[model samples]
Target: MTLCLSLLFLFTIQPSHSITTTTAYAADNSLQRVKARGKIVMATSPDYPPYEFQVSKNGKSEVVGMDVDIMKQVAKDLGVKLVVKSMSFSNVLVAVETGKADVAMSGINPTPERRQSVDFSEIYYNGGQSFLINKTDAGKYTSKASLAHKIIGAQTGTLQYNLAKSKIPGAQVKGMDKNTDLVLALKTHKIDALGIETPSAEAYVKNDPDLKMIKSGYSLNKNDTGSAMALKKGSGTLVAAINKSITKIKAKGLPNQYLAQAGKYMKVNTHNTSMFHYWTYFAKGIEYTLLISAISVIFGVLLGTILALMRFSKSKIFHAISIAYVEFVRGTPLMVQVMFVYFGIGIVVNLPALLSGIIAVSLNSGAYVEEIIRGGINSVDKGQTEASASLGLAKTDTMRFVVLPQALKNIWPALGNEFVSLVKESSIVSIIGVTDLIYQLNIVRADTYRGVMPVFVAMIIYFVMTFILTRVLNYFEGRMKHAK
Candidate 1:
């Protein structure tokens, strides 16, 4: 009875303390605290052309756009220095919610689900969504009826994607992760059309002569409602300050000035031309990716073989150390490990990005190869070791002459599979900016405003490489068996 009463008392106190902590945290996240910090971190997606993009002019970063210019005004009004951080659109929301950034202003539209986590400032710019199609198919897509049974692409979780699904009920919609992906899908003939925003589609098609928009008599499910900046929930003070700044910018025509300047680089009108012409710029990216993967695999195999020997060595210290290495490498995620080795180690080692990629991938591959080699070695018969011993051979001689030859024959197939996995795994090195196949794909998507062809090309190249490796390994294995 005493224990039950104690438990009840503890439960009763928990809710009150929790509420007190929540209220205190809410009070702490005020405009005064933000101003005192003297810096406002703004999250944006650099992949969106004419809104936010990364460019180097005379070896300096210049992020120029209507969105950037407006955010700068807001920061000045708040008496805080502006710091822009580039990330994916999805990650922008995460940054705002986590308080990693003061606000997210990369063409964000207020949605119901988003409101649950963060508050949005009043609309800043009015923008409507539209569809871009190949010039040859522009006439055929005059109405919803003409678009029936055709494959259409749109970025995932966007207003355009939702509208396309509801309005074009008969159209097959393929969701992508970015606007560039939608453009690429249309360009490659992977999809007949792409549902995109009007400004973004216009910006993409300016350089392409093969893509066009069907602007005549299309339905607007939602108005090109103005976009707004997102803040953490209940940041009324910050929201009010941003709104006041936006009002001033509108009155001074500063927004228009910024838009006009941005227009110089982007197309302001819809035309029929290929928007994916920039894909040709990423050929060098493909070469870099292949080089990294090939070198990593070669070095990885050599290191793995050495580690495998260590694990099987008679010395207790070598065996223990090898076991620890295998466990450590296999236990961690490849992406985290790659970042740690590249970014973390680069701070101290000052190695080139390509060398860091090779070292990271090789270390990871070596751990798995150790297991594969150990398994192959054990699969060899004990009789071979005993026969070598009877011939007055030393333990090392027995392994080198008798055991390893048979083990290699048995392990050739597994080794080939490991090589294939290593090739695919090399894609992760791109996160540290190693310009692998996926990195090239991203570059092509950004430049051409297209996403499918580069990915398709990458997939084909990986398949061809794996196929050839398999054939070569199989031929070697066959020769080994015939010799025996």
Candidate 2:
């Protein structure tokens, strides 16, 4: 009784909105929800330093920087607590568009594509584009005429990417997911230079002696390039409220003060830079990765069974539908499926990010599982079915007692491979804001600002996970064989 009451109270409770807060949720408005909950949920990418990045103190991790400072002030002006949800820069806008978060801020620039999806506030700060290149050849190629056929990198889905494509006419433009990867890419000459925001470019130069920002060439257009908070379309009440906060802060010149304070702690070695020290990140990553893989596979088995049975059905309709599902799922990339599931179906059903990711993965895996199970059933000899029928068994009983058990035993190893594949493919979920092991590695990469090494460690962690899971599956297979 006590536990039930506690659980009920936890879910039902909502804090009283301050009388000073004018935003009311009479119709469950976004602003009213924030005030009534006494917390504003913000989505950001913490890898962008001086704007937002991770900080470690006494072995605990927290996000801190200029963007966070501004949001904190915004929360204060609205008389609410701020709750931040960190994710990929691409997904940050998705979170806002889906109403999963109240606002999105991470040094995000206003672009036409983004403007079509979400509303932006009055620009908080402006920055032109710049490049961080290798120190060995910093001044070797300044003129656009001399820059032909060089490789340049930028973070995907950002203003810098567009700038790289337009500004450098003859260069190979590489768009990476994380800024740290681009940093490493530049230092190693995987790319000749990296286009990035001015602040991050400066931070990279300041943190490492091997990096230098090229400022004399390629003056990037600053139009629609200012950072701003993002909210859902048609969210004028919240926008106006946040704008009021932005106005107050700019009046006090708080943005400059925040930037100066963030710069003071922006040095790389000022905090824990050791991968061994942040074992919690890897451990949690492995835990969630395995859990998502296992849950996804388990659900895949159930869904696959249905799909397989449909393929075996005599009805052309069920068979066509199953075939179409399998081909479409196999044909499309998992990344696209993840986006549609999260943004399209998720918005309609209002699913959380992790659940949406799991469902997407399960649906993708199920299509393949269907083929595996169907082949296994077909591989069973006709004699087995005849023997079961001769024993006076019904069709369903024959399938259950004779066909499925033998089919499972025959394809156990193939099924094991499917499970193993799901574990690796599960990494795709990280892009959609699932904080599995790979995402944590990016967090560590951004925090330490050492790009390649973190990836090397993540590679080892993934190998270990797949290896252990394979062995566990093998063990279960051996036991099942012995029992049979």
Candidate 3:
């Protein structure tokens, strides 16, 4: 039976691979022909507020700041409708390459490795890498030479990461996916400094009173200019159109205009602000946290049911295997499990990051729920099963009709508890770059350099969501019990 299942899996995977290859090729071809249509889709990361974040007043998306303005002008020059799709920074590159987007217009640098897959337009911005260090330690690292043998943090898959590793050869550089993590690391003194973009570092210094940029300006090599607007290779029409728009924007001085607008909402000067802005940013993060929690809970409940049935089987071998599965899942930490499933399994499987997060949370929650279900099933009186047997009912029907209904009524509260636990556990999925609530809060706190607000907001949001869900579950359990 195992061999047959393995063969079936192999057959299933073969078709999937073929389909993926075909889809990739088709996307590439479609992008090449996009000039025939008058629409250019540009992908940007919306989490980077003041650059490309979504404003949620009336549910209509209005792009703001230098990057958004530049892309819109570029689209107008091409005589195409400009559609901005908000996604994570990493996914932005994939969107461009897959022809889902004509260009990516976040503050993406033109790395040589990226050149192999996509073409870049002229450099729009010229900021280089700099470090944000604790105010007390600011004087310790005066230059790149001084940074040698020190530890620094940077956002992963960035030019800052590359420059930090290369410039300070002896320095220990840790690459984090979220900007908030780098700030947290600095706040906790986990790292000596944070290697960041000049604009981001400037923003951090403005909001964070305890942190300051090193006086000695550290930067990437002059050749490695910070630029934007990445296009897929062979998209000559799109490239030409974007270049013309950039030239026009430069001549008209639109970049400076956009910067001035962005400066209004963001701190332009290096000074602390009232605590009001901090809480506002924190409220923004709550929206994302609730989203991740809700999705994880739904998936976890579905997966738990499957796991319970497997554990309840009559076969001794199945029972032993199920016991091991429960032990393995419960024994490990949720954070480590999230990382393994998202980054580790992601390397082998071709699932989207969000889908991977759901699968991981569900699988983990299912293990505990299995034991809950088994205990509930066992609670059903032995006489009930004996009565079913005397009535000539099969073992499956006896359990399905008599045992399961009673067991479910007893276990309903336990299931609700498991769901509440799953909501909290889902926070770990942020490690794999899902833009869920904790992840969004981290960005807000990092950018604002005020951690208290975002943390508070996240806590309140989680508490409220769990409270509501628990109440609903209790109501259902009561109804079920009364019906019985």
Point to the candidate with the largest TM-score.
2
Kindly indicate the candidate among 2 and 3 with the higher TM-score. Answer: 2
**What's the best-to-worst order under TM-score?**
2, 3, 1
Error of 1 at 302 (Å): 13
Clashes of each: 11, 0, 2
**Model 3 deviation from the true structure expressed as Cα RMSD, one decimal place:** 6.5
Tens-digit lDDT string for candidate 3 (1-484) = 3235435433432323333434544455433455577787778765554465433224332445568877777767766777776555666776565445678887788888776667788777766667888899766776667878899898788887877887786989998866666788888999988887666676667666798886325544554556767876655555665677787888888877776676564543113433354444445445545666677666665666666777777777877877877888889888656645543444345456577777778778878878888889989999999999999999989988999899989888888888787777777766555666776665555445555666777788788988998899988987997893
Error of 3 at 88 (Å): 3.7
Of 2 and 3, the candidate ranking higher by lDDT? 2
What is the C-alpha lDDT profile of model 1 across 1-484, one tens digit per residue? Answer: 3235435433422323334434644674557867988989888776676676544345443555778888988888999999886555655765565455689887777766566567788877766666788888777776555677788887777666776677776878899867776676687799988877666677767766678866413454232345788886657777888889988888898876877777663442112113344333345455776677678778878888899999988899999988988998899889767655544443345455577778888889889888988998999989989988999999989888888888888888888888878878888766554556676566545644445556676677778877887888888878888994
Best of the candidates, lDDT? 2
Model 3, runs deviating above 4 Å: 1-39, 47-63, 97-100, 215-223, 232-236, 251-253, 267-383, 394-396, 409-414, 426-436, 467-484
